[model samples]
Target: MVKEIVLSPDEIIEYIRTEVKVNDVLEIAYNRVFAPGIVLGITPEDEETGEGLRVGLALTGEILSDYVEVDFHRLKDDILEIRHNPTGDKDDEEHLIIIEAEMFDNMDQK
Candidate 1:
């Protein structure tokens, strides 16, 4: 099996444009999963960077086909569980990275 190396948010995005093997799920950010090319950039509220991402899956089912949104303003913790649906506007069946949100630790601060 190939070893999966953890990369930073910026690094992962760069990888997608250069050496992105799987478009479905690019890389795991702080905790939230990222789809790289899908998102324009991290949101402003995510400045703290202390969130939890259970999953950011790429929908492969036939039902969800036109759902394309990759939000990175939800990465906080160091654990992300991505679970997204499929992407493809009825014409293309290519599944790309989809935005996702989870838990953040900003509230548990001192």
Candidate 2:
């Protein structure tokens, strides 16, 4: 069995750093769809469990403001999907993810 240990946001950054270098290609998925992105940086965010991390990504070096703060608990199953950096016209694919405000209003129902 795989041992499960909860890690803080800072520790998560350290863990990812050891595995993936800056600018490494990665894909973020939600609700069964995937978006291509490149790693820019990682930062800590406050959470009840004290293990939230804000991940930064971009399509190119010119624009790097895309960010996502994911709770550590949500990562229990998978961390990421790593892929090779795209080349040629294939590199133009970009996806922007937006969370609807209603998602927060109904959290208690789940």
Candidate 3:
């Protein structure tokens, strides 16, 4: 079996522009804004749909203790759907590394 890969936040951003063969299990290192924990199941960019990267917040580790969880399959459906901040109307897309706070809270719910 191929070994899982762990990528930093910067690398995750890079994957958005460049296509990378994602492993079965992918880990995204902690980003201060998202808290300190690894995010798993990073969906690679979908060329056909022209979508960006979307990463799942893992259920295990510090995330679990904090009551955060991610639906891996749904997150992979459409990367473009991911947004920054709780409100969908936010204009924070200009930020290089952006994650939707509401998306995390919504996805993390059991």
Order the candidate numbers by lDDT, best to worst: 2, 3, 1
Q: What does candidate 1's lDDT look like per residue over 18-74, in tens digits?
A: 432333333333333333222222222233663321223354444543333343323
Each candidate: how many clashes? 21, 0, 0
Task: Give the distance in Å from residue 53's predicted Cα in candidate 2 to where it truly belongs.
Answer: 2.8
Cand. 2 TM to true fold = 0.38
Worst 10 residues of 3 by lDDT: 81-90
> Once superposed on the true structure, which residue ranges of model 3 sit more than 4 Å away at CA?
1-12, 15-32, 59-110
Sorted on TM-score, highest at the top, how do the candidates line up?
2, 1, 3
Give RMSD to native, each candidate.
10.0, 10.8, 14.5
Runs off by more than 4 Å, candidate 2: 1-17, 44-48, 59-80, 84-110
lDDT of 3 by residue, 1-110 (tens): 12223343344365433532222222222322232223434555588974545554433344343323443333432232222222222233343234322223466655
lDDT of all predictions, in order shown? 0.35, 0.43, 0.35
- Write candidate 2's Cα lDDT for 1-110 as tens digits: 11234444335445554544356555544445355556666555465665555455665433454544433335523433333333222243442122111221355544
Q: How close is candidate 1 to the true structure, as a TM-score?
A: 0.30
